[model samples]
Target chain A: MNTDWKNIDAASLNNLTLGEAEKLFGLEPNFTEEELKKVRNALSRQYHPDLNPDSGNIMSKINAVYDILKNEIKNRRNAEQNNANGGATDTSSTSSDSTREEPEAENINDNAGATDNSTSENTADEPEVENLNDNAGATDNSASENTADEPEVENLNDNAGATDNSTSENAADEPEVENLNDNAGTTDNSTSENTADEPEAENLNDNAGAANNEPRNENSNITWEDVNRIGVENLTLDDARRLFNLEEDFTENDLIDAYNRLDRIYNPMNFPIGSEEAEKNRATMNSIYGVYTILRRNLINRQNVQESPTREDTTNQSTQVSMNPTNEKADNSRNDNGDENSQNIPSADNEKNDGQTDRPKDAPTHNEKPALSTGPTVGDQIASNDTTPDPEPIPVIKSIPAKIMDHRKQILIIIGIIALAIAISQAINLTLVAQMARNGNLWHLTAGVAEKAALHAKNINLTSKLIALKSSYDSLSGVWTIAGQKLLTGNLQAILRGISAGSGILGLSCLTAGLIKKKSAAYKEYKKNIRQLIRDFNDLSYDEAINQINSLRENINNSNELSDREKQLLLNQLKKAEKLNRQFEDIDQGEELEGGMSL
Target chain B: MMVDSIITLANNKNYLLLMESSILDDSYFLGVLLDDNMEPTVDYVVLKKVEKDGVVCAQQINNLNTLTQLLEEYGSEYAENYN
Candidate 1:
């Protein structure tokens, strides 16, 4: 073999020769010539791909190992030479096999059953040993430098001793399942045998293509990308090109109907009908019919594949599908896109209408002919040039416009977000303030007032009891004076009337004083003022309520006509009522204004 | 004979694998492929194990793709045509 083989791992092969291969393959005690041939044949036969084509890489490894051992006399001799220097490894090998070979009980039974081919097997191995002996004198086998165009190597058919024979039997016996790789060794890529292998590859691909329409199975990990690539690669481009020659038949009626419909519906003027774009569309529509024709032809081709007869009617292009209606529809469609395009680029259309072409004359032009050699053909040149944008260098405005668009989009989005936030906050605030105002707390204040009224009623009760006792004392005095005078005199009656009058005046003054319990309220105006204060407070009129409460308390404290006890009671009551009013004044609604609470 | 049941049993979890090892020695796409997990497939049929005895095995079965193509197109048709 040439030393410079491509892709061989030089280091790995070198080690196999002298380094550690024997140790690695667990063949430390070198194989005797006889043993090596047997192992090499066994391994090679086991993995030979042809023996088990389905084995894939498993057989290749076995084949590879056979290569190493087949001409391995050089390596075995290397070890034998090592032993000539009296190495213990060499002594062990001779010593061990001798002992094992003489095992009388096991040897006799094993040889007895094995006699079916033992004599022939031993004879078969003799020539191989002679080769090894020859190589011992000269380490390199002459076979290594043999002719490059080597004849095909025969499969070692001594398959029974060679593991292959057993597996083939194994494979044949079990028809239900295929045997795995000939042997365990990994094999190489099978690309070279194109003719023999092509069948399997196609089978796999066909299965893959139809697999898409089949329900998915879990073990199948194939993906659409895999199938699509396979479909494309496996496709015979030649087939498609040939499809053009096939007869038309599959969608005959429908194609004709569509053609007729388009002819009637379309308006050609709307299309700018003679324009290149319209012509291109027209070409595309014609090609579609071409595809339709091709597809119909394929139905027959497909039918052939299905082993079915082709549909025979409508041959020779007799049924020309009506092309009129679709032609009209195509024109109408052209008009719609034209109008939309013109509306979008009014400047272009407007210039065209003005008879001044849309092309800017002063624009820098590249790869362009001058429109004017001051030539009469300037109009034609300008129109043609206007229809095609000058292949000029990229414009500065293009970059600037892109940047401006990005910034514009970003700015608009940010501003829109900010506006939404502001509107949301305003709405939430309005809702909360409305809710707070409606919360009134009027009932809570009414609750406070009821408590105050209960206290005042207690005070009034005590005062009235005192006044009732005083009236009884006056009545008794009138009775005593009468007892000392005439039994039914007019003077006695007058004295009793005077006592009653004094008691009524005393009671009325006490009641009036008690009712005006607080200092500043003009008692007659108290209800109206207090009510107004409550209304102002609920309406967020806090400052006004505070002003009124303070004024009432101040005025009451300063008043001089009251007794010390009544004044103290009035002050106490006013202090509590004012405290409640102040609490309302300090109700910070959590919103701040530039000025104090608006009234 | 086994695993028609096994085929049914292989369920979604089972997959068939057949790889050519000879490619690793030299073939561009084939040689380097490896399954680190080492879960071997039972269903696939590997043909012409890549290399054997210091020679590439696939050299013997060239034009494999063609045979596969013929079978795909003609296999079913033959069955129906003959039927």
Candidate 2:
């Protein structure tokens, strides 16, 4: 009756069931496909934008509604085909029934069976063809305006004829088709009623708390973002419940209902086998099951807790039983006098038994026992006196020092890298010196020496002869001539030997120095002493700090293995420590003198 | 003393003072000068040589006093003690 369907937004339209949507077209929820076509034809003709150009975007809304309803019809037919083909067990088939609730799930078979009866009734729909023709003939005058819908109506007629032909083939087959379509068309109206009663029945059960958790948004169009927002692999029970749109006051029934609806919505079969949409749906499906299982387990645990009395309650009951050693005898007497005392004397024991049984078992949070106790409320006192005294919190360093401490390891690693680089470079230099020796490339040095010797001779006032010698020496190559071949060879040999010896000595010295630095006890002792001295200085114990500094200085001076450079570094540390100690001593003396006098 | 020995050797002209080049890099020469087909014909040998700016620049290494001063200049006054 509310045909202003143009006012509905896409989101609300997506949420609409086939029954609600069919009502927008002014048709009953139980309308056949042929009747649905008739309704569409009538609605479109009345609201065609070309005919009613002033209706704004009414045509778009009509088209959107048409497309969505068409999809639902297509889905229903697919589900029926699947059922006929014995593919009803297909998990995807369940997903196609997304709008159906859990209570309707049981009626799927009943509805399918009832639809057989409805389809047989649809055979009577042939008489209604004359009315459809009349409506179609009325629209012929506005042929140009109705051209878009004409072909579609013809196709519907063809489909209806095909259905009629199929109906004539076999009554048994007709029922299956009828059941699927009938359930598809009238599912909302009939199933919704069936489900309403079922939910009430479920609520009446002791696990009524679970029934309250039924998801309110039953036919939501879940998207990829929604699936991602409810993360799949790490899907929590709460997130799963939220995904199902369940409320806080939930029961096992609510969880099952929510799971079924969501499972149908996220059926992987709805999307392409391996498409992004399918993957999203699969994740959602897995998450739904995951959440369902957790909630089911929690529900079971809760029910178990409710069914079994609390540990304290059991203990108290046992004590009551022990105190009343005649409980068995009393029970036997009560049974014997069941008709007499049932109306006369209301026993306190009977009242207590009734109170315990009637006490709320819905949640563990309810402190019903404290209220039942006639004495001082010990439970309330214990709860009121609950105090968890926490330990003192550590001081959080919020300054540059904290940052530096964090990077201390990185700083040490960098320093070690630099030291390694320097050592590698030094070793490389020593290798190059050895290589120079091995190559016997001492001719350059020989030429240099000769030139210097010539220059020295010149400096001693030997003049022209010395100058001539210097010029000859400076220009000399390492090549031998006939006159001094043996002499040049001998000189080259000696130079090579001397260079090899010098390089070997230099390499040995370097290696020994590295080994000594690492293994030297004197160096180690000096480093330890210096570090201790610095600590003492920081402590502000002037006398002790001064004594440590002196001791460190003595250690460094006595250290035979430390090089001059190492000794200098230690001495610098010593000077700083001595200065700090002196300053502290002055402060100490001033404090002492002040203590001796008035404040 | 080394300068006098070099002068006497040059004056006699029995020994030829020869060098490979007027330039020295990290590579250097330090010994008695010998001609091609080298023979150590002289009675004494030089222990040091100095080259600068791609030339046979000075006779300073020929003087022991100047050599010791150079070592001290580079902060090795205790050079013999280290050796």
Candidate 3:
């Protein structure tokens, strides 16, 4: 019936996470109430998580999709029932089939809570649980056969029942999803056991039939396991060369096809992280990603190596595949897969009506799909869980409570969080204000503005605690600035006059003292010499007088030359002379005096 | 000895030594010890007056030794400059 198998191929729903989809298909999932219960019971039996073989996990993913869809339907029914009865559930007895009607393993977990041993056993019983579905399906086919103009339900698992039931095709379970989902459960654990035992038939089916139908991009089947096992054997990146009957030189498109083939099989999101299986698979997925990276790198390297004549492009060189064949590990190169890969899911009309009949009779046409996250729109809810290769939708409604409760709680929490955030923000703002005050030259700027306005404000020198101006300058800057300008312009010589005035008084006093002093002719001569010394001290260049006076002063300080009166008189005269000479000691004083400059 | 005596009195009294650098004309030497923050220290050896800074323009024992050695090395140069 899938005449347009390729055309009718619905886009895969691989992107939706199982739990998010589960929200859409809550306890009463995406499937109808009746159909959800049927699929739920069947799945609980098939994928009794703990008891299923490691390989049975592929089936578990498929069944998880189914369980989520069923739960969504159940939740919708429960919500409707709640609305009908004013929002109170009588917890009288959870055994009233409504709880069972919910698609979650919760009822089972709750039922078997007292029996821990049964958890694994319940899971182990999942494969056999489909048997009950088969019986139920038998009952439905008999009943629905007579219904006039009944819409056909697309069940995909029809053909795989060769090992189980004779009428398995008519009991097609997920027949529309056979290429993707059915084999998912098989690869993880069963590949090792099954591939080793039944390689020829299964291998041929996957390698040949699966590849062409999948297109160059749908590389979901050639799993990490396939990549790990395939080596350079029948199926390799170079496998395209054999298919097209060409040499190893293949186009980029061929490589992409091979990579896609390899990609479809590796289940990166198969299990949750930190789970034992997920951790194991993490390593495996990383290696698979690494392999793809290597293939890309190899192709690029080969292209570069061929094109570059000078080997200057040393970066493109790599050790050939055989040399590091086994060392080539899988990586998360695809784990960081971009948005383009996950962008579009299947639209409805193009879906297949493949005559997949392996599904059990009486199982609802809208079998439950794997759980995915909450979809924003109703269409998304359906689309997220629509794993069917062909969109064979059995009508579902929009009934589950919009995440209003979550939104309300979030709003309240956000209000509290924002209050706290505001307090912190305010505190930070205050600290910044304080820091800004510390940095600003508030006093200096006012002083500057004052100085700018006033004239003859005898350059006030103020050192401030606050820094304000662009240079963080204090009022002292004005003094320094005036001083520097005066210094540069040779006008600071006037201040030196104050220092020299003291010396002039002292020199005249020394002259008078020397004239009054009584002594012999030689003492009079010495007194005369002293008077001359005072005149020269006043008249001489500052350097010459300072040198002579300093020498004499040192000698007198060291010597017991005169009596106490002589010493006291000499000291007073010396103090005045030294004061006069001190102004000239400044380099600017001597220079300005000699040149008649003002600085 | 007299300066140390004055310092001892000052310690008992409420007066404070605000500035530390000592200069006579352009000839000045710094003997003050300061803390990491550059505050003057006064109490290395004293308990109550934990000197944040040191004695101003005085040769301490270590420095006296250093100065003796420096003088021995650069004594002639200094003498010439003095002359």
DockQ of each candidate, alpha-carbon based: 0.01, 0.00, 0.01
Q: Label model 1 with its docking quality class.
A: incorrect
lDDT of 1 by residue, A1-599 (tens): 11222233322331133113233333545455555444434433343232333333332233233334433443345446766867655332233233233212121222222232332232233222122122110011111111111121001111212112232333343211111112112122222432132222222212111222211110011211111111211111111111121112323332322222221111111123244322322322222222332332333233223233222212101111111211223223323444321111112222234332334443212212323333222222322232242122211111001112322222222222222222221222111111111112111111112222222223334322222222111112211212112211324232222222223211212222322335443443443444344334434445666677778667656766555565565455444345544543332221111011010
Name the regions of candidate 1 deviating beyond 4 angstroms. Answer: A1-20, A23-25, A57-60, A75-599, B1-83
Ranking by TM-score: 2, 3, 1
The reply for model 3, stretches above 4 Å from the true place, is: A1-12, A15-221, A228-235, A239-273, A302-599, B1-83
The C-alpha TM-scores of every prediction are 0.12, 0.18, 0.16
TM-score of chain B of 1: 0.23
lDDT (C-alpha) at residue A441 in model 3: 15
Ranking by lDDT: 2, 3, 1
In terms of lDDT, the poorest run of 10 residues in model 2 chain A is: A129-138
Report fnat in order of the candidates.
Answer: 0.00, 0.00, 0.00
Evaluated with TM-score, which candidate comes out highest?
Answer: 2
